[model samples]
Target chain A: MLTLKQDHSTLIVLSVLADGPSYGYAISKAIAAKSDGHFKLTASGMYPLLTKLEKQGLVTTSWEEVKAEGADPDATGRRRKWYTLSPKGHKQLAKHIEANRQMQALLDAFVAPAVNDQNAHA
Target chain B: MKHTHGNTPKPKPPTSRDGIETWLDVLTSMLSLPSSQRTQVRDELEDHLRSRVDDLLVLGKSEAEAIRTAISELGETAQLARHISSASRTPKSFRRFAMNATFFVLAGSVLTASVSMMIPTHTNTTLPGATEAIVVETAEVTEPIRHRFNHEREPVVDVLQSIATAYGLSFRFSDGVRKSPFGKTILDTQLNTFKGEYTLKEAIDAFQARMYMTYGETVLAMTENELILMTLEEHKRMQIEIQAYQIPSWAESDDDQRNYGFSIEQLISTKHDLEYTTIQPVNGSLVVAAPPEVHAEIISMAAQLEAIGKSMQAQKTQQRIEQHAQMTRRIDRLRAEYEAAKSVYFAEREKANEFSNRIDELRSRRLFVRSNDELSKEQQEALQTQINNLGEQSKQQEITTDEAKARFERLQSILIDAESELILSDINDALPIEGMNDSKDEMRTVSIMGTANMRSGIYQLPEAGKLTLARFLMAADVQDPNGKVLLQRGGVSEPIGTVGDISSGTIDSIVLLPDDQVVITAAD
Candidate 1:
C-alpha cells in the first residue's frame, strides 16, 4: 500500500470523523478501510493529528463508556474518548477536497500527453 | 483468554496489556507536548493499539503475534514525535522570540549607559549659531525663488555665486578667506543640483550646515549691496561685564593685573575667531567683547578653573586633618610613657630614703676612743680637725645614701686605730668619750647570729639600732636564721675591731647591727 503525504494527514483524519462521532481507534480503522488499505493511518500518527485538529477547533471530543457484552449491570464499563467533526472541520474538509480535485485535474492534463505518446509508440 | 468462575480475578483489557503499555511508553517519551496533551495522546494511542490487536486476533492470529503486528503498523516513534512536537511548539516559539527580544533591549540599555559614562561631557560644535540662522532664514525665505539649475557635482563656490547672481546679489570673499583653513574646507566641498526653485539664503544655509558653519551677518555691517559669506567665527559680537568682587585674588597687583587680563584675552585667542577682541580691566571691574561663540568657551574655562581651586582646597583640608590626628595619637603615647617613668622614679626615691634614715640612727650610738700618749698634741689636733671637717660635710643637704655610708666607714676605721693605740697605752689614761652623754645613754641593739634573710644579696637587720660595742661585736659574723653567713667581718679568725674614736671632735658614730646592717651616729 502506498503512503499518503504527511500534509494530507489532517484532511484524512477530518474526513474519517465527518461520518459521525468516532473514537481514535475507529477513526484510524475507518481511514485505512476507506482508502482500501492504500493509506494506512497508524495509531501514533492518528492520535496527534486528532489532537491538533481538536486544538484547531476542527473537531471536538468527549469520553463515552463502551461496555463488553453480558457484563455486570453495576459496573461502569470501559471509557473511550470519541471525536466528532465540527462545522469548521466540515468547511476545511470541503476546501481541501476541492483543492485536491483541482490538483488532480492539472496532473491529468500533464500526464495525458505522456500517456498518448507512449500509446503511439506501442 | 479463559475466564474462571466466582473467586477468579477478571482478566485485564487489551489496552492495559504488556505490549500495549510498552508501545505507549515509547510514544509518550517521544512526544514533547504539555503533560495533559501527552497523556491524552498516550491514552488514544493505547485504545487504537488495543482495537488493532483485537481485530488481528479475530483474524486467527495468536495473541503475541497480533500485539506485535498492531505495533509494527504504527509509524517510527521519532518521526511521529517530531510532527507532534512541531505542532505543539507554535505558540512557544513566539514566546521564545519575545524573550530573546527583551534580553537584547536590556543588554542594549546597559551597553548605552556604559558608553555614555566613558564619553566626555563637553562638545565642540558650531551648531548653535548655524541653527539660529537656519531658523531665521527659513522663515524669511518662505516665498521660494524661481531659480533653476542643473549641475553635476560642481564646486560649492560656483554654486553659491550662481545662486547669488540669480537673486540679483553680489557675493564677496574676505582678503585671506580662500587661503584660510575655513577656505580649504569650503573648497573641498561640492554640491550637485537638479532643476528646482530654491532661495539663495536657504540654499547657502543648507550647504553650510553640512560643514558645521553658520551663515549670518558680519560684525561690520548688514547690507544688500555686497553679500558677505564669512566663517562661523566672523558672525556676531558679544560683550561680558564682570563685577569687581568676582575678580580672582591674583589680579590684584598692577603688573599681575595686566597679565591677568592678557591671559583672559589669550584664552579667547586659542579659538579661530580671535580677529577682534577688547578686554578692559578698570579699577573696580572688567569688560570683555568678543565673538558670541568665544564667550561660551571663556565661561566654560572660568568654571573649570573654579572647580580646580575648590578641589585643591578640599585636598589641603584633608591633609591637615590627617596630620592633626597623627599628632594627637603621638602625644597620647608619650604621656603614657611619662606617667609610667614618674611612678618608677618615686618608688625608687622612697626606698633610698628608708636606707638613709637607718644609717643616720646607727651613726648616733657609735663611739670613738683615742690615746693622747700614742700621738703628739699637734697630730692629735690635726686628726681632730679632719674629723670635725667630715662631720660638717655630713651635715650638708643633698647627701646620697652611698655617700653617707662611705663617711660612716671612714669614721669607724679612724676610731678603731685610735682605740687600738689607746689600749696599748698604760691601762688607758682617761678614754675621752666625745659623743657619749654625761649620764648613761640607751642603745638599741640586735644579735646578728640569726635574724633576717638576705635581700638582693645584702642582709637586712631585724631591728633598727645604734652601733654600740655589743652590737658591733655581734654583727662581726652576720647570718640569717637559716645559718647562712651573709657577711663575715674581714674573714675567719680575724680579730674583732673596736668601736673606736668617739673623741675626735665628736665625729659621727658608726653602727653595726644584725644581718649586714650599719648605722652612722651624727652629732646633734
Candidate 2:
C-alpha cells in the first residue's frame, strides 16, 4: 500500500539479507511479508540497488541453476543469482538500524506532544 | 547444476513459453550491458519472473492469467533498462577528466618553472658588445627582430649569428645541439633562410619547428638577451613526471583496446626512442613517466597513429576494390586472347583441309587420264606434276595447322594460369598466406606447385631483394636430395637445377620473382 524510497528500500533489503543470503524474488517476498504487504520495492528499484551494492562490494553474487520438478537431468534449467551480505554489508545494516531508531525517537517527540494537545482540547 | 562461464555457447531463449521468453528477449536486447553481463542479468531475471508466474499459477490462476500477472509485476521494461544502464556503466566523463587533469598538472608544474627560467632580465643595445651578456628585459624579448640571409642557402649558424647581430644579442648552443650526426655541428645545417620579420620568440619557435620536422629533436629557449638551443631529449632530462594519456577508443572489444595501447607505446616509446621513459598500459589508458615535453610528444604521436591507422584501413579497402577490378579486367583480357587463338586455329585447320581436297582431285584427274589411254603422254605428265605440287602444298598447310594448334594450346595454358591467379588473389584477400617471409611487400606472392618437401601454397616474399632458387629452397626447408626443380616464369618453364645441386651452391644463379612458380619432379 506504500511505495518505499531508495534509502528505506536499501535498509529493508540489507536487513532482510542480514538474516541470510537470498535472491531477488525471495528478498522481495520477505519485504512483503515483514511489512504485511504494505511496503513495495518494484523490480526496477530492486535490481539497480542490488547492482550498486554488488559494485560497492557490500554483496557478493553467485549463480545456481534451478530445475523444475521431474525435469530431465541433462537439461540446463533456469539460473538464479544468489546475493550474500558481505562483512561491509553487515556494518552498513547496523548503521541503518541505529539511524532508523534515532529517526523514530525524534518523530515521536514531535507527534507525542501533538497527540496530547489534541486529546486535551477534546 | 554447477554454472560455468566458459566457451560454451549461451543458451537460447525458450520458445515463447507463454510469452515469458518473448518478453525477456525484448528486455535483454534493449540492455546496454556487455554480452557476458547481459546474459547473466537475463538469466537471473528469467528465474525471478518464472518463480513469480509459478506462484501465481499455484494460487488457482489460469496459465495465461498467471503469465500476464507476472509480466505486469516487472514494471516498465524501458525504465528498468535505463536504471540498470546507469548503475552499470562507469562514469566516462569523470575518468576522462581525471586523466586530463593529471597530465595538465604535471605539464603545468614543469612549464611554470621552465617559463620563468626563459625570462630576460635586460634589453639589447650593442651588436659587437652583445657577447658581454647584453641584458634584454622580458618586455623587449617579444620585440620584432630582423634576420635576412646573404645568400639562398645559408648555414644555420650564420643565420642565427645574423639575428644576433641585428638584435645586439648573444646566442648559446649546447654541444649536442651544435653537433649534427651527419655534420660537425647543426650550425652547418643548411636552411633556405627566411627573410620575414618576427619577434624573438616567434623566430626561435619557427626555427625550432623547422628543425624538428627536418631532423629529430631540437628545442630553443630565450634567456637574458641570449638564445639557447638544445636537443629535446636534453630538455626532457631536466624534469621527469608521470602523466596518464587516454587512448581514444578505436574499438569496443578489450583485445582491440589492448592493441591500441600497444600501438601507442610502439609509436611513442619505441619509435620515438624515448629510452629512459617507462610506459604502462592501464585500463585503456597509457601511463607514461617521461619529461613534460616528451609527454606532449607522446600525446601528439598517439593522435597521429590513430589517424594513420584509420587512413591505412581506408587505403586497404580501396586497394581491395581496385584489386578486384584489376583481376576482372585481366580475366576478361585472357578470355579475349583465348577466343582470338581459337579463331586462328580454326582458320588454319580449314586451309589444311582445302589443300588435302585439291590434292585428291589432282590425283583423281591423273588416274582418269591414264585410264583413257587416248590422252597424250604430256597431259599425263602434267596431271602427275599437279598432283605432286598439290601434295607439297598440303604438307605445308598441315605444318601451319600444327603451329596454330600449338599457339592455341599455349594461350589456353595462359588463360588457365590467369584464372588460377585470380582465384589465388581472391584467396589472398580472404585469408593471410601462412608461412610467408615477414615482408612489407604483402601484395606479392610466389606459387610453389608440383610437389615439395613443404605444402604447395602461395608464399609471400620480402619487401626487397631477390628470392633466388637456392635461397628459397633453404628458406622453404626443402630437403629433397634428388628432386629436379624447374622455375616457371612468364609461362615458360626452365630447369633451375636439382634441389641437391641448388642447395649445395652448384646452381645458385636462378632468382625467383613475384608470381614465379617452382615446379618439383622426381629425378629421372
Candidate 3:
C-alpha cells in the first residue's frame, strides 16, 4: 500500500505462484521469463517479499523437490524447493489479476487512443 | 521473545532424539512474532509446511529431505536477522517500538477487561459506589499545625487533608457534592501576606506606585492644588492682620526662619477690632522651596535616574535578544538580532540626549548663566560670545554616550549633596505644626456677606418697591437726596427703622443729612 516494496518483486512473486506452487528459485526464473531479460528481481529483493507476503498471509509455503519429466538432470534440478498458495493467497492473486486486467483495458480504451487513430489515418 | 518470521534464519534444529520437544520449541519461537504477523507467518507456515512434509513423506520422501525442502522454499532466515538488527540501531526506531509496545499493552489490557466483564469474573472487580474506608489521623499544633493521614484519596488531597485535619477540618460532604478549602494548594508557601494585611508604610508605597502608574495627572493636580491653597491661605491671613492693625509690623530678620508660627513680633501686637479664637494644623511635611543650587541638582538627578532606567531596559532587551540568538537555527533570528541591535543603539542615544537636555536646562538656570545672560550692555556681546562657545561645546561630541552617562552619574552625586542641604534647610524654612498652631490662634478670619450695625437694633435693611431679600450698609447723607456718602452711624435695618415705607411713598426721591444712617435691602 505504501509502495515501500519494489513492484517487480511483488509482480514476479504473485505471477509465479499464480499458477500453483513454487519455491523461491522457481519464482525468480518465472520473473526472468515474464520480463524477457528486461527485468530481474534479485534474491535479495525476492527473499524479503516472501517474508512480507507470508507476514501478510497472502501466500502459504511448503517444501517439495522438483522432478524432471524425462531423465532427471543432476541434483540441481532434482531437489530444488517449492512454495505454494493458500486460500487467502488465491483470493489475493485473483484480485491482483483482475486489477491488472482492468488497468490494461483502461489503458487501451482511454489512454493513447489518439495514437491508434493517427496510425490508422496515416 | 523470539520473532521467527519466514525469512528468519535458524540454526539447524538440534538432532534431539526427542523430536516432539525440538519441534515444539520451534513452534514456540514462531509464535513469538507480532500477533498480526505471527498468525500469518508462524501458524500458516508451520501448518502448511508440516502438512507438506507429511505429504512428501507419504509420497515416499524421508523426513530430513522433506524438512530441508520446506525450509528452503520459505527462504533464508538471515534476512530477518539482518533487517531487525539494523532497524534496532536507530533511536527513532526504538521510539516507534516503545510506542507500539505501549499500544499493545493497552490493547491486551482492554481485551482482558472485556473478556472478564462478559464472563462475569470476580477477580479484581471494584463494586460500583463502594466507598473505601481508610484510617485518617487527626492532630493539632499551634497557629500552624502539622498533620499526617493515610487514605485512598489523592496524595495532594492527602497532604491537604493532613493540613485540614491538623486544623480539625475536612471535605464538607453534601448530597452528591463535596467541598474543600479554597486555598488548598500553594505553589509556593513562602508568600503569605496579602494586601489586606498591608501596613501604613506599605499602603503609602503601593498608593504612590498606583498613582504614578495610572493617575499621574490626578495626583499632580491634587498635589499642586494643596500647595497653592496653603500658600493662598497664608497670604490671606497676612492681609487680614494688616487691615485690622492687630498684627505686628514687618521686620527683616537676616537668619532663616524655622516653622513660621506666632513669632515674637506678632505676640506683642493687639487690637480690639478682632482676635483669633483657636486653630490647628494637620501633621504634614511642609516641603519648602529649596535653594536654586539644590533645585538644579534635583532636576539633574531625576534625569539621571530616568536615563538609567531606560538604559537598563535597553540592555535587558539586547541581552534577551542575544540569548534568543543562541537558540536559533532559523533565519528569522538574524533579522531579530539586527532589529535588537538597532533598537539598543537608538535607545542609548536617546538616553544620552535626555541627559544633555537636563544639563542644558540646569546650566541655563544657574548663577553662571544668569550672570552671563544679565551682563551689562558693554559686556553683553562678550557674554553672548561665551554663551555661543558653550552652546557649541555642548552640541559637539554627540557620540560620547559613555561620557554623557558618567556625567549623568556625576550630576546625581551633586544632587545627593544638594538634596542633603535642601533637607537640612527644611529644619529652618518649613512651618512646623507648633509654629503654624501659634499663628492660627492669633488669626481670626471672619467672613461677613452684608452690613453689621448694633446701635438701634437695626442691622438688616430691606430694599424698597421690589422683592429684594439681601441687605448692605453705607454711611447716610441726610441732605443729599441720595444715600451714597459715609456718616457717623453707618446703616440701619430698613424694614423696621430710619426709612419710610417705600410701598406708600416715592422713595427714590428721599434725601438724608451727613450723620444719617442708611440701609439697603433686597428680597426676592
Candidate 4:
C-alpha cells in the first residue's frame, strides 16, 4: 500500500466533497471504499485537516440532524457535521491533480528502468 | 400473554459511554481553543464515535464490545488534541503590528491637516524701499559674504548690530520705531546661538524671521540718514474707513467724549504710526492710517464689543421670558386651587340644602300633629311659636346642618312635654272639692284628699295673692304620684298629703275659698 502524502489527504477530502456535501464518517468511508481498503482514513487525521481547510477558506462545514431509517419521529438520531467544497477548494483541487499527473509521468520514466534491471536479473 | 414473576436484574450503565465522555473531557481541556470552538470539536468527535459504534452494533456485537472497537478506530485522544491545538493557534504579533501601523497612519494624517491650517500664506506686497531708485550707493560687493559665528544668550538687537558692523554698514532705528510696543517686545527677546554660514541676504532673512522686523534702505534718500531698522508693520501703512455705527457711542457728557477721543489717540500712538481723524463731521465716522495688521486688530476688538452688546440684549430678553413663565405658572396654580375650593364649597352647600329640606318636612309633620283635636288651643299656640323660631333660625345661610338637627330634636322634646302636661291638667280638673265649704273659720280644720299621689299641698294666699307650698307630716303616707297635678295661681305641682299645724300664739288662720281654692293667712 502506498502511504498518502500530507497534502494528498486534503486533496482527497476536497475531491470527495466536490461531488456533494458529506459528513466526516461518510467522507472517510468513501475514501476507503474507493481505494479498495488500501487507504485507511482515521478520525484524528481527517478532523484537523478539515479544521485547517475551513480556516483557510478552502471548505465550509455545517451541522445537520440525520435521523435513522427506523427511528421514532421524535427521536434525535444523530448530529452529523457536513462539509462541502468551496469555490476556492475546487480551484485548489484542480491545481493539485494537474501537479500529480506531471509527477506520475516523471516517476514512470525511473520505474521503467528499474523494472528492466529486475527483468534482466530474473 | 404469559406472566412470569421472578427477580429481574437492573440494567447496568454503559461503561464505554462513560469512557468516551471522560476521554472527550480530557481532550477538550488539553486543547487551547476558545470554549465555543472547543465545544464544537467535542460534539463533532462524539458524533463520529457514536456513528462508528452504531455501525459495529449492526454486526451483532454487544454494546460494550461495539463501543470499545469504535474508540480504538478513532485513534488516541492526546494526538488528536495536539493536532487541533496547533491548527487553531492565531498569530498574535503580526496582527498587533498591523493594528499599530493603521493607528499611526490615521494619527499622522490628522496632525498634518492641522499644521497646514495653522501656517499663514505669504503675499507679495511691495515694500517702500524695494524700488532700485531708492537704493543707497554703498560699496558693491562682487561676491556674497558668508559669516560663521556663535553667540550664546545675546540680545536680538545686539546680534543684528554686530552683523551690520561686520558688513561695514551703519544702522540706525527710525523715529518712534525703537520705542514702539512691538519694538519693546522684540528688544527684550534673548536668542540662543544661531550658528550657520550664509550670505549677507540669507543671514538678514534669518534674523528678520526671528525678530519680525525689516531693513529700510530708502532712509538714505528719504531721511538723509543711515540704514534704518523698523518693525515689519511700520513699513506697510494702509488707510481703513470706519462707518459711524462701528464707532462705539460715547456717553452724554462732553468730558466723556473727550476722554474717549484721548483713549483712541493713545492706543494708536502706542501701537502704530497712525492718527485718528474724523471722516464725516456730523455722523461721528472716522478714518485711521495704520498698517493692515493693526487695522485687523482694531476690527477684531470692535467685533468683540458688538458681540458683548448682543449677548446682553439676549440676556435681558431671556430674563423677561423667564419672568413671564414664572407668573404664568403661579397663575395656573392659583386657578387650579380656586377650582378645587369651589368644588368643595358647592358640595357643602348641596349637603346643607338636603338637611334643610329634611327639617322642613319634619316640621310640617309636627304642625299637623299639633293641629289635631287632642291638643288644647293654648298648647297648640305654644307649639306653633317654637316651630316658628326654629324655622327662622334654619333659614339663615350660616346655620350648619348639625344646628338644624339639634333644633329639630329640641322641638320634638318640647311637644312631648306639652302633651303630657295637658293630660295631667285634665285629670286634676276631675278631682272633688268637698272640704272647701266646711272651712269658713279662720282656724277651721280641713281634710284634703285626692285620688292621685301627692307629697305636698299647694295653697293660694289671700292678701298677698300668691300660691304657697306646705309639706306633709311624716305620718301622712302618700302613694307614688304616677300622674302630674297642677296647682293653679302659681301653676306649680306639689305632692299631696301636706297640711298646716298651728302651734304658736301668732294666730295663723286657714280659709277655704270658693271654686276649689284654699287661702291661708298669717297674722301681721
Judging by DockQ against the true structure, name the best candidate.
Answer: 2
Candidate 1: where are CA atoms >4 Å away? A1-3, A70-77, B1-17, B78-82, B85-90, B93-524
DockQ of each: 0.05, 0.11, 0.01, 0.07
Q: If both were scored by DockQ, which would come out higher, candidate 2 or candidate 4?
A: 2
Per-candidate clashes, comma-separated: 12, 6, 22, 5
lDDT of 2 at B43: 85
DockQ ranking, high to low: 2, 4, 1, 3
Candidate with best lDDT: 2
DockQ of 4: 0.07
Per-residue alpha-carbon lDDT of model 4 for B214-285, expressed as tens digits? 323211111111234543333332123232222444333555555555666566567755643332222232
Going through the candidates in order, the fraction of native interface contacts each one reproduces equals 0.13, 0.27, 0.00, 0.20
- Every candidate's lDDT: 0.48, 0.62, 0.35, 0.49
Q: 2 or 4: which has the higher lDDT? A: 2
Cα deviation of A58, candidate 1, in Å? 1.5
Give per-residue CA lDDT, model 3, range B139-178, as digits (tens). Answer: 1111212223233323322332332233333422121111
- In lDDT terms, how accurate is model 3? 0.35
The candidate, 1 or 2, that scores higher on DockQ is 2
What tens-digit string does per-residue lDDT give for candidate 2 at B1-524? 24332222223233223346645654664465666877888887888877776666445444545555676777666556556655654553212111111111111122322211111112212211122321111110112333543434788777766654455557777666667473254656787755666544445545554455455555554432445555655555644556556555455567776776666667665455666677776665566676544555664465476569767766775786688678779878988988998999999999999988888888877778778887899988887888888888889989989999998999899877776665545444432211222223247777776654554777775443345567566445466778888888889988877888988888756655668888888777
Q: In model 2, what lDDT does residue B385 have?
A: 84
